[model samples]
Target: MPTAIIAEDEDLLRSELRRMLAECWPELEVLAECEHGADALEAIERLQPDVAFLDIRMPGLSGLDVAHAVSGRCHAVFTTAYDQYAVEAFAAGALDYLLKPVAKARLEQAVTRLRERLRLSETAPDIGRLMAELDRRLRPQVETEQRIRWISASVGDTIKLFPIEQILFFESDEKYTRVVSGEDEAHVRKPLRELVAGLDPEQFWQIHRGVVVRAEAIARARRDELGRITVELRGRPERLKVSQAYAWRFKAM
Candidate 1:
């Protein structure tokens, strides 16, 4: 029986994939479920699983990096977002991949191919061509992605434009998104999800589903007795909750 490992950052997606894999390939024993690529790589190296399902974009090491490192040792099935350019790149390079919100039919096809590869005792294919293609196609978008330089939020009756650098953190309330900077705070009609795309990932990190904090503003992270981490800010009184999915960011290596 072929053993497998699952590596995805999101808890919900990882669980859904595990559940689906049981239904589609019951004989495929799952060795581990990892929250990040680093753990996935470590698990792969230690267990030597025959198949690995990896998410493309993760907190530390990317799925592509893990695949590159383990090219000849295991079979890789990439899980990526629904980007046409990335899909085209995967198709062009003949790499196996599943899109986010994976359909059962597509997953079954991927499973079939992997089973065939295992039957033939074939090693995983190298991904240089795919990486180069992704670098060419996605570089422009990543460069221009951080377009929100100034946040125009409402400060009571007056609308204030706060520089992106000035923001300490962003938290979503019931409806409005609260923008906090030191002692000052403002409300925005926009949701945190809509605002996340324009923020530079290097500068702002999504610690929680409803919380995004400026990296510089974080003083430290403290894990409580329950193993829950809350991030302390440099100047802010309120600490941010680090969700289980993102807890890998603060794990000590």
Candidate 2:
């Protein structure tokens, strides 16, 4: 049986797509339904679904952004309401898409193609080129201004700026998030959720709900006898717990 996840900001559209999938592809197990692109990306990494139905324009990471970030991982089926010019880009590419207010017949066609692709065990195509083109044409004035460059945190008596690149990991509680850098550590009022929006997905991976660690800082991952996994970091004594949901990152091949 195939597995999939749906991502659409609109409640009705998300539900409608799920209903349509059940109708057209009954055997397709929906691993998750995501209302935000960041959640969708995390779900894809965590669930390892066979297919992802992504909304082209999402709040934080757009569908194109997610597709590019997880290239060659899973098949992507974009759901778009782009102008005719942008729609033409999809038609000219190898990717599949369903227009907004997706018609049943079109979705059925997409389902059929997905089944065939899975049967053949086709490699997922890299969407870097398509994303660049689509991004350029869709949001010309938009740049990645949301990515955090610095974390201004208070030291003993003064505030210090930690470059986003040098940060090792972030652990959060209900009220505050702890920022650890190479030189020092500090606590801020922001939660992990809001900080995720500014952090680059490729740089910071959410190992646990309350923790986000730099991929480069990871030294090794060990699974205990109880089957729980923990991550050890370079030059750091603390071992971060990898939750079951994110344990897929260290799965044995």
Candidate 3:
């Protein structure tokens, strides 16, 4: 019997999927159900289930994020609603996908495919190219939804709301995003990726894996002694490294 785990944000959908799995695939044991990507990643790391039914989008980490974290640990069956890009990627990868409100017929088909692959003794499904394509198609959609308007931070017991425009940069350290405004900085609970979405791209540019700087605050770009490019912020000497992949963002600087 294959052990499976479900990772989804919505409680109703998670329960419904569990009920459907019980009715349709009785042999598969549901080892766990996670409500967010961070929790799901930890669960998958611990359980090491044979199948993971992951919702494509979630607050913390995406289903794809979980998949990337647990690469080759188990088969990934993505559950998404109206994400045609991910659906097509699943089809292309020869992996299974359960559309939201998971139709019985589709679920059955997915089970059949899973069984066939098991019988064939396939070691792992190749999902790299498929995931890349899905990211490409959904990047714009993700960016559109990542607008930061009101920011809530706290100095002590009292909370404060700072307009997004007041932020000069975002720095990631120890899994926390630190918002910087000139010399003043404050900590926020949101992760770097989450903060990136909430920020305006025209104003913020991710210059490094750990740093996203305000575009208007860029003072200049210069190559270091090691031939690596780094950016300096206006009126600030804190140099931020620019990865080659994201160097295009500072091309005009």
Best by lDDT: 2
Question: In candidate 3, which residue pairs get closer than 3 Å at backbone N, Cα or C atoms, i.e. clash?
Answer: 146-197, 148-198
In angstroms, how far off is 52's CA in candidate 3? 0.2
Residue lDDT tens for model 3, 13-122 = 99999988888889989999999887887888899888888887787666765665565477788888854435223422325666688998788777776665554444
Please give each candidate's TM-score.
0.54, 0.54, 0.50
Q: Which whole-number lDDT from 0 to 100 does residue 173 have in model 3?
A: 77
Give lDDT for model 2: 0.78
After aligning candidate 3 to the native by TM-score, how far in Å is the CA of 88 from where it should be?
8.4
Q: Model 3: what TM-score?
A: 0.50
Model 2: per-residue Cα lDDT over 45-146, one tens digit each: 999999999887788776765665576488788888853223322422324767788999989878877776675564437646655554344332323436
Residue pairs with backbone atoms closer than 3 Å in model 1 (clashes): none
Error of 3 at 237 (Å): 11
Question: Residue 92's C-alpha lDDT in candidate 2?
Answer: 24
lDDT of each: 0.77, 0.78, 0.72
Candidate structures ordered by lDDT, highest first: 2, 1, 3
